[model samples]
Target: MTNKPAQATLLPDNIAALTAYSSAKSEKISGNTWLNANESPYTKEACIEIRALNRYPDPQPQVVIDAYSTYASVDSDQVIMTRGADEGIELLVRTYCEPAKDRISLFLPTYGMYKVTADTHNVQINSLSQDLLLNGEVKDIINAVSGSKLVFICNPNNPTGAVTSVEKIAELTKSLANKAIVVVDEAYIEFSESYSCALLIKDFDNLVVLRTLSKAFALAGLRTGFMLGAKNTLAPVRKVIAPYPVSTVVAQIAANALCSDAITQMRRQVVILNKAKATLIDWLEQSPAVSKILSGEGNFVTLQLKDKALLTLATNTGLIMRPFKLYNQDNWLRISIGNEQELKSVKDWLNAISAQV
Candidate 1:
């Protein structure tokens, strides 16, 4: 019997180099004031009264599917519920792109999951060159379509908050027919003025829209999201998904939240956050510490701060916000639109810190 040297060769080269998603919370930093993750500050009371804990959950829960379908104004066949929108990204890559053969394209400075998911599957990732604020141009996406099997577009894009018009998204899909599947992630659509591209599922087969209860619905803790596309288009994705992707309790709670009264409450909360978003933008615009602010339609605002020390000061004073070194923007900070009390605390801290400096 002989023991061989243990080297990194045991793991695939790509897997060895992967840096998984990490957030402040993941780092065990629990702050009294949290404005990261773009989550709704309001917490929904769960209605988890499932009697069958011993039984497996449904692969596709009709109650949740129907509820989300009605909310998105689409048919149940077009909806495929997953653990979260993150899972949908993985499912798409697994279903469509062949490992080490097919490739996917994602715009820079957008959501990180699309690249992460594609990388996990050993699929090649093509970076489509486009400006963070002025990159919604269809021609740029169309030109990048060559040699790509999937294309991911995050609307009211995460981190930067830039949005692409529905017309442009539809046009991009039509232009790239059979070239790639254009996935429009609309997780923050509830907070945007643009209509969901789910309505265009019937018009174009290449378009897929991702929605989540984590944002405006205030159910981030529940971990529920959906992918809206033609049933035939998602059939392969459904096969790749777990047999029981959603828990019974999660389904029940999501169903309850989609009720008429709950939806009205969600809309009212969105209205409040929209106001907070505007206020935050206006305040940031006037702040001496802010060098530039890339305002978008998302619930959060991205700002390029004049001083990086402000981020450290905020964290030291029990305030937590997302800082990005992504896309070569090192001094950028992302602050989620929190409830009035939370945002007020941020405002107070900025004033105190600014006055001292």
Candidate 2:
């Protein structure tokens, strides 16, 4: 008889209790329209020249660093590129939190990765209500997250598109100085540039802003992002990051995406998507199926449905949208702004549903 392999060991309690991040389905499921993941509706192609396949890429590609630094209005040393902002989150957690000892904090109805990464590192998570950050005073916010090592604030917050004032964020950083690192995840900032907390990095040593090319730059496939802060804040993270986090092709494409011309195109696309989102909001406002329009500031619109069954109807029509059960309600749905045709399909589906009611 053939010898059998030994049984696999059970996962640690921290990991055993966790669920994997539920990313939007990547496979084509008889639908050509995909607007679930907050990805840019437009695609800007880059003229890539592949060279040096045999050589390893720079851990932090200088070309990408220089271009992003100029674009973000930060010094070259202030930026450190990662596989994506997701990796940046992981790196920050790994570098700061001590397993089973230190904890990280975040306001809920925000990005899920903050808690997920902290959990993966075997670190405790302190989840405060979004109201604490949105409505609480700086001291109150500080008191709430007193023992945490890193605090993640997702401005133009995911799923909700609610933006916290830069002044409020700056105040929180100042109050929490030396107590914890305030990480502002600006994955959707390109859609709402004026509210960004990136400029506050120079003044606050404890503040770090996370950004990604995945959304606005329309380079999701490249998986490029940056962590911007004072060099000291990033030094520890650098020690823990992979030696070559960015692949050669990713660096070339991301560098191209950050070029002056590409940035202009991205701005133009943002304008277009903003208009599309406005139209979608208008439609949602008139729909009987939509109970409330929660937010539409970012690249997506979130609303509470009059009936949760509407989500099933949408999916049945080959329309995919992100579903949420936020603040004890299970009727919320987030629809990404897609191309004109895709938006039209959504509108038509909503109209048909409205007529039935």
Among these predictions, the greatest TM-score belongs to: 2
Runs in model 1 with CA error above 4 Å?
1-9, 132-137
lDDT of candidate 2 over 1-357, digit per residue (tens) = 775444324457777787777777644455556778888878767776676878988888998899999999899999999989999999999998899999999898788888888888899989898888888888888889999999999988887888899999998899888899999999999999999888898899999999999898887877888999999999999899999898888888888888888889899999999999999999999999888997646899989888888777667888888777877999888899999999988998898789766
Residue 17 alpha-carbon offset, candidate 1, angstroms: 1.2
Q: How accurate is candidate 2 locally (lDDT)?
A: 0.87
Clashing pairs in 2: none
Residue-level error in angstroms, candidate 2, position 298: 0.9
RMSD per candidate (Å) reads: 2.0, 2.4
Predicted structure with the largest lDDT when compared to the true one:
2
C-alpha local distance difference test of each model = 0.85, 0.87
* Superposition error at 181 for model 2 (Å): 0.3
What would you estimate as the lDDT of candidate 1? 0.85
lDDT of 2 at 146: 94
Q: Write the per-residue lDDT of candidate 1 for residues 221-274, one digit (tens) a residue.
A: 888999999888998887789889999998899899999999999999999999
- Candidate 1, 216: how far from true, in Å? 0.5
